[model samples]
Target chain A: MLEIKNLHVKLEDEDKQILKGVDLTVPAGEVHAIMGPNGSGKSTLSYVLSGRDGYAVTAGEAALDGQSLLEMEPEQRAAAGLFLAFQYPVEIPGVGNMTFLRTAVNAQRKARGEEELSAAEFLKLIRQKAATLKIDSEMLKRAVNVGFSGGEKKRNEILQMAMLEPSMCILDETDSGLDVDAMRLVADGVNALRRPDRSFLVITHYQRLLDHIRPDVVHIMADGRIVRSGGPELALEVEQNGYGDLLAEVG
Target chain B: MADTAVLVAQVPTVEGKVRPGQAALAAHLDALDLPRGGFSRAARQDAAQRLEAMGLPGARDEYWRYTDPAPFNAARPEPLEFAADDATLFTAIDRLHLVFVDGRFDAAASDPLTAEGVEIESLAAADAGDDHWASGLYGRLEAAGQVPVKRPFAALNTLAAADGLLIRVTGQVARPVHITYRRSALDADVHLHHVVKLEEGAELTLLESGVLGARSNVVIEADLARGARLHHLSAKRAKDPKLGLGHIFARVGAEALFKSFTLSVNGAMMRNEAVIDIAGDDAVAHIAAAVLGDGNIGRFHHDDTVFVIHGAERCESRQVFKKVLKNGAEGIFQGKILVKPGAQKTDGYQISQGLLLDEGSQFLAKPELEIYADDVKCSHGSTTGALDETALFYLRSRGVPRERAIVLLVLSFLADALDEIEDTRLREDILGRLEDWLTERAGNPGKA
Candidate 1:
């Protein structure tokens, strides 16, 4: 469902390269986890896939379901079924969360030649999806992510994912600021959406999140490259021994 | 004596007569036949003298530094014709609808001037009767507000304005007074002066809408007595490129409440100035304006000058102004909060913000806070910025198109000022207009 080949990205204003020739692929119906230490270009890879500006892709390609995402705008990529759950959800004042969600849902549907959802229909569907994430009605009525707690913001992102039903979902540090209970709730939301046609690329520094949403394959990323690929056991190995031995072995 | 008269002019003496750009003003004034035998003959004479002394604001004036007064100085503006298709807002509500065509009161189109506890009469029809309630308030507030700052346009309106509404509210009125202006002639130049007086403990709401024609001047003087409440809302549509100028001079009495909000859209040039004086203790005054200008057709400039005075102890004042400019549009905001001596415990808040859609657009804001009272609480803020990039990216990443995202952000920027409206239905009505403007600008009617 998602493919990346020799992806090299650099800051637009500076010569510093963040992602250096990284190659990875997650086939349909599979969950992949990319584990790395600090400065391993984990977040950069997610932003590059989502088509954020101010980043120059110096080399390689990224495709979603055989469609090149590098050429598409951020919103076009979203309509093509690529969702990036940001590590820091932006607080947009004066825009209600419910309205934002409805706009996003209808926009994607309209782009795909689907009929727009009525307000009543949207409200029902969002309520049902929000129930699973435990997001109350008050939170839905407030401005988008304004004054929201870290855990609430993550849950809201998951709610969006459920509503849009994107084929490829990239969870970037979703568990970074969440507590134990919030993490469990988020894991439950993601576990419910797992299906045969959908895939996920879970990027995180800790293996704790992997315990909830177990990955079919684990890739150890270092120096902007996928150095090793293995099963779920690889995450446990790294968690126990840390990345010091792994970096030495790669060197 | 000639030298003394020149000294009285308070400028570089060229002659006994303080004439700078009075040629154009004199031509315009010569054409306007002054109404004879009114209650404010002396006040009108004084204002006319002041207008002569301080000619129309020039490029060198301190307050008119950012705004060029050349457009408003034309001898006679060539009317720019426009067909307005949008229906007048707030028509469904039950209220006294007074219509003005080409700045003249259309008695046939207006409702009968009769209501319980309310007296409505046109200044043109009201004779110079000493018993008339409006005679006292005709030009009282306008004259009082000219101190420390000279508003020549308002002074000119005080003298030449005859076709305007005079409203007196003695008790609580259930219906609002809706004043609508319609332009029938393309070359019409409208001048209006309105007076509103609320008796002690009275309450009333005033609604104003319509697009004044080429080279128009309007001044509304409101006097609120003790414990009275006045709510004023104006939605000025700019369908054509014309020079629309307006001034609001109000004196709020002790324990009275005065709230006013103006919504102005695209125009070639527009200026709305508000001067509010909180005279009574424990009174509250709020003045806000939201402006949206489009420079796609031609040069668009809009200015909002607001002055809020906290003159009594424990009085509160708030001034909120927001502007959205796109495609080389220019927006100017000059706001000041003044707290007089002995006005302790005065709470004043002022905020002016602008959202620039592109690089060509400009926003100029001058915010000032003058406080002589040591125990007062006053704060002011001014900001000019583009739409938040991070917020834009977030919205786009969620599948909202770029154009729709920008519209949402722009609306968000103006939300605080819009929220100042006291009525829900009126707020929604104005919100709809804003969304329509955004949709038209986006050129995506179906999507936006």
Candidate 2:
């Protein structure tokens, strides 16, 4: 459902290239995991795909179900069924989490010419989904991530994905700050949202989070390019040997 | 040419006949012949001299940058000929009534409450013997620097103010007193001076409402005693699309609390100036205001300036101002706080936020603070931005439609200021008016 062909992006006014000829594709009913060391361009790829500013797509194209994703604005891309679970979600003061989620969901609906949900219907839908994710109703009433703990904010992002139910979802370092218990809860939330027609690209630094989600394919990235691709056991091998073994092999 | 010359001979020069407004004001000042003792009297004379020297504030004056007072150049409103009948105005605000018509107190409309150890009487009736605080504390709150270069209207108010309210609370006053200055006549100018003395540990709340017609100018002076607390909330809802100006001078004693909320919803040209002085340690003062206008309804201006003296340690002061303008309406917020050398541990915060509903609307916010003390926490922020696009989109996405979303967002933007009012009844009343204004805009969306 998602395809990126020889994607190259650079800082707007600088010669430094952040993403150098990166290529990836994920078909329906499959999960892909991209593990990389610090500054390997994992976060940059998510930002570029989600249409955030300050990144110039020098060459190549990113398409969702054969539709161009690079040409759309961030909100438009969100409406087009593209969701990026930000590593550091913007803390929006005075905007409640439930209010923000409803706005985003209804905005996408409006863009697609669908009837909007009433307050009662919205409350019912969000409440049921939140229960499965173990998110309390009170947490939804607070300002969007405004004083939320690290784990709660990540869970809130997943809650948004469940509400929007995007065609393609990108999890950027979702496990970076989670404790063992919080990581398990986050992985469970993501697993529950998985479907046959939906796809997820989980990015992380450690193999611990993968123990719960169980990706079908695993890719190791080094220096802005994918260096190796293997089955789920590859994650186990990397966990034992560390990125040093992979980096030496790539060199 | 002969007819033109004859008309020129018949007409009086600008200097010979005081512009009708100026002439009436001069006559009122001459009639008062205020004694030299009281600060109100001395301040009046000083303001008059400054008015004579500086003249009316025109477009050229930096302080009058957004609004032009020249429209008031034509006819000066005389004090109302008859006592103002305030039955209609008093009903609008549900509280104990204190009525002042044409700058004179009306005893018939006042309530008798002596058991609470609170005295409410006209300044004219106040005795000099036992009412020592009234005379001693009166005019003690001095305006810092040279008194502001007087505009003609202020000079006029200083000159004409006569009998107003003198509220003295020996103990806590449970109920708030509603002071209504109702202007029914077309040409009416009322000058008012109010003295409020709260003995040690006393508390009082005063609600001021100004309802006036065409050509009205008013001024007020207030004083608060040591260890006392006072909250003043004033709202001006003027009709006739004429001119109205109000000046307030207040002094707060040591360990006292003074809080004020001023709202200007409709006016042709309205200016509310407040100068407050914090004289004692542990005192707190808060000034909050909200103004809204559209069309040729004129401009609303507020100047809140505070002066904190030395030895007033642990004093706190804050000012929050918000304005919404549309259809060429203009709003201005100019605030300043000065901290003296020994005023350590002072906490002062000021914020002014505004929204321009249309391209033609304008807002100017200036917050200035001067601190001489070493250990002080003082900060001010000003934000001038259009409505949040994301917020609007979020609301519209919920099937609320675009116009309803804008109304809700605008109301939410103003909710912060409205939430500050301690009285729920008054807060709801203001919110209801705000909703009505928003509804009117929603009904006629095209005009905006």
Best by TM-score: 1
Model 2 lDDT, residue B208, Cα: 78
lDDT of 1 by residue, B164-219 (tens): 88888999998888988888788877889889999999999899888767778999
Once model 1 is optimally superposed onto the true structure by TM-score, how far is the C-alpha of residue A233 displaced, in angstroms?
2.7
Docking class for candidate 2:
incorrect
Q: Which pairs of residues collide in candidate 1?
A: B254-B280
lDDT by residue for model 2 (B1-448), tens: 9999999999867775555444544544554535343434545556666556555555576766655656544444433233332233225554677776655666776665343757877765653234345555443332232254344665554444455667788888777888777654556544565667777778887887766445555544556668888878876654334466666666677889888887766444666666767778888888788777665444434333333333478998887888876777777777777888889999988888878888887777767788899999998888888877655533432233466556666766676676567777777776766666677767874342
DockQ versus reference, model 1:
0.85
Give the TM-score comparing model 1 with the true structure, all chains together. 0.95
In candidate 2, position A146 carries an lDDT of 73
**TM-scores for all predictions:** 0.95, 0.65
lDDT of 1 by residue, A161-237 (tens): 99999999999989999999999999899999999999999998889999999999999999888999999999999
By summed lDDT, which 10 consecutive residues of candidate 1 chain B come out lowest? B439-448
